[model samples]
Target: MHLSEQEPSSWPQWLSVYHKRALLGGGLLLATALLWPTPQLTTGQRIALPLDLSSTSTHFSVPDTLEALADKPAFSTTITTGDTLSKLFERAGVDQQTMYKVLEADLNILALDTLQPGNEISFYLDENHQLMRLEIDFSLARQVVFTQVDGSYDVEEIQKKGQWQPKAVSGDIYGSFYTSASKAGLTAGQIQRIETILKEKINFARDLQAGASFSVALSEQYIEGVASGDSQLLAIHINNRGKQIDAYQFSDGQYYDANGESLVRAFLRTPLAKTYRLTSNYNGKRRHPVTGRIAPHNGTDFSTPIGTQVIAPGDGVVTLVTDHRYAGKYIVIDHGNQYVTRYLHLSKTMVRKGQRVTRGQPIALTGNTGRTTGPHLHYEFHINGRPVNAMTAKIPMASRLNKAELKRFKSMVSQRNIQMGV
Candidate 1:
């Protein structure tokens, strides 16, 4: 019977095709069998099924060999600002599955919502398609791991203690601090930190001369032969115009000037000449106006009308300048040694990087840009990479003047106080 003779649903599609072809061959086969005489020895001839043979069953029983797995490279990338957890994983060459596993493994320790810039994620895979390790370089200070166990991962944190090797170098400010420091084999981070340490007492960023001399004794950190981070300022000295200021990082983690005075003795000077209207006070932390997020506000804010000139609190080199959303326009000055000063929320920058500026010199024009509600100058003073409240900073009384200069300043103070009827 032909398959088409039956209903459409009678048999499967594949089976219907086979059955139709079989029927077509059956008529020819019947004719051949009748035309050709029934072959003799038919009793001895018998159809044999492949499975019916014992050897066939044994031969098919052998399984095919498996292929060896390939090895993968361990890779990681540091996170930058405006990065999300998903983006971080992609840069590290990980898929969504791995990212999900990593998030689940250390939900508390590695919160996706709290991830910061400069963090690194490292991936580890085995030949068996298993996630052997999911590591994170948190703050470049430690490595956190998530190890697989029976298909599930367990979190384990490992602190990496970096190695520090003391190095000493000297260079003159031929053109700029960065160029001069780089020529001496110093990284950008190191150069920036040095500017921050000495920003308060000296103003190299804005006042650096072409022939300024600087000497630094610092600890260079190494993680497998790569410079990682710095700890303390072992020693630093900067000489300009016959004035030499030195700072030493003591064993107790305090930075002292060569005169044994604290490098952090005073607050960052307000760059604006007139403190007309105080816009923002020195707070431990403040919210970024543009980002609308809580961040440490390292400086004080002075408000004034637009076009008001801004001054340099200390001598330093202009390191960075940009028109940021919140800061509007900002300038960074690096003081010789490790002191750095930052002036933000400006309408214009009067001075550029590598330009020498003196204390009270015009560096910028006041206005609102970054994280501001009005026009003001945001001033910051950093020492060893940490922001200090500029308002409460107590400047060490300008060194006791020599007898003659002391008498002169005393008379001046007395005369001024009398003139004001104090």
Candidate 2:
């Protein structure tokens, strides 16, 4: 109880003893930890836990492994105007022997006979640059394939499944209809079709003005989720100088206006698909080039190359197929209602007398067989036995559809109207 007065030395001794004992205990604990082995846990004895995948993102990729595995080189090209299959094969580095073999292998493969522009042709060549496989796209939905088999070639026709995708385009004309339509992504073929449908109603070359608007509804072909670059025009609406023209393609494959009137005319302005220069006009009392005498130049003259296809301007019965000293080889088509068309100086005549011909049918070939000084086509349009300027004359249109067809056409094209936003 009174140890506070005499515990100074005893306190020092107690503190020293306690410090040594604590140090000894710590060293012993460390030694035990280092010497003892940790217990190993098995899969069955481990605790189950949930994985956290919320913060992770998964991705997928498709590699073109087949293309990588192919040893030969593949070349593809589009057919252009005046392109031949042999020329294409040469361009693809195929040898002449291989080309001849492919050609002689299949006589029924006439796809190369009519080489349409824009068709695709592909070639696969081996290490020796010999053609091993060839693929020709006849159309968007059809292809012909030729593969080397047993030192020969085997041909196979493949039909592709395609879907129709509705497409719509609209634009306003600032200059020419061609320029504006091209800017709106319409091809020349499509523009020509539209012109054919509306030529009777609107003179595109003369009547189109600034601010005139147009809308076109068509279908684009899609195969395997890829567009095949082929399109079909379905419906069109044109507002030209406050006049509205609507044309819809019917199930019968003819274009009809909103009132069910056929857009095809009885006569086409030009007989040839290719445009030509007006060498001479329909004139009376003109000095003849050969005779140097005043003669009546009754027909219009178009200067074109020899063998140019001449088409029937209208549906009519062939009245005369004869050769004269003055007119040379000529054809006379007698359209009813006191109308007649004459094509003079042809190299070949395809239609015979008394044969029925439709408009746009090829009837003859242009030539220099007549008494003319140069190669040209002499076209004459007669009305009631008198020659009139076909380029400036007002040609009559074909008869319109009856009331029942009009109703049905309107009903069938009602959805097209909605799609065109009419």
Candidate 3:
């Protein structure tokens, strides 16, 4: 209809209608937004969630392990010069109080007071640096253990079981007996015993030739499948320039020949039981070491370590025990047959004058007490008050074993000889 000309009066009515339509359209738009579909999550999609720390219900705690706290480390050390047990313990981080406690726990700990070089000791410490265990090697076969038990120390002595294994070694002398014997795996103690067994029969320094040979059968000690340093010589044979000298260990712990004769002679060549070098011979005219003047050196000198045991050459009475200007601390033994043996430069005299001593008995200790430049033993032999060379002079032999003892010794010798393949 052509309302433009007639709608002036009806304008309010038309405006009201238009307002009602606008309201209806706004309501429809609101409903459409409410009913619309949203996007959905896929099956493999991941979503990072935020932590909710506001809850007071959750808690965590760590569990303790007692085994870990009980473990400890062990320390081992060898005793050296001037090293004491207290110092050694300190080096292992142990306190003096604890060491003293352990030491006072038992009387066996007294052995540690006599410690020497080359001894070994071990320590075990806990996490708190407290000494838990201590082990000391008293010898190759003996050990002592101090353990912490119930907050106190307890001591125990353990003796190791050792096996004795027989060993045979043979060698020929090229330059010196010591050199050749060492090359054949002979220990120093073994070599010394060998020399002593043959001392009465052969002069090692003079009688040993280039081709002189020796054989020894010994028993070596083994502990826990390891070789220990203890040994015993069972038999020895020396062949010097086609002369054979055999010695066997009898039940009496002394060496005897195959004919049941004692290997110990009437007089020992030197006062020392161990092997040593001859520093000076019995010379009528020679230059003295300390004085540097020509003099009659009436005695033979043996170079040895200080404090080595000086043994009696024969059974005799001690006639003189005095110190001299040239001879330091000297001892003179007088045998009944116009024979006398003198030992000079002694560190200590173990015997007093008028005391009777048997052959091979310790009479003194070697030292540098006299007018000498070094540590040695000056030994002199006199026959009817006349000085003679002890090394080359004729020396008598001790009486052989009695008939019954000889018979038993012969049987033992036969068995040992078969074992030694002699």
By TM-score, who's the top model here?
2
Worst 10 residues of 2 by lDDT: 40-49
Segments in model 1 whose C-alpha atoms lie over 4 Å from true places: 1-163, 168-217, 224-226, 229-268, 285-296, 394-422
Tens-digit lDDT track of model 2 for 5-74 = 1111112344345436546777665344334432311000001123243554523222122232122234
lDDT by residue (1-422, candidate 3, tens digit) is: 11111111122344355436545767664344434432211000011223343543333211122122122123466777888666666555566667655654432123454467877676654433456677777678777777776555666666666999988898888998988999999987577667756776788888888898888888888998788787778888878878888988766555678787777556777778888999999998777666455546778889989999999988777877876545678888876445778888888999998787888999999999857889998888987556799999887565577888888888877776666666
lDDT of each: 0.56, 0.69, 0.68
Q: Write the per-residue lDDT of candidate 1 for residues 81-153, one digit (tens) a residue.
A: 7777665445334456655655544422333434557676555443222345655656555556676665556
Where is model 3 poorest over a 10-residue stretch in terms of lDDT?
40-49
Pairs of residues at least 3 apart in sequence or in different chains that clash in candidate 3: none
Better of 2 and 3 by lDDT: 2
Off by over 4 Å in 3: 1-74, 78-86, 94-119, 124-133, 138-140, 145-159, 264-405
Ranking by lDDT: 2, 3, 1
User: Which of candidates 1 and 2 is the stronger one according to TM-score?
Assistant: 2
Query: Scored by Cα lDDT, where does model 1 land?
Result: 0.56
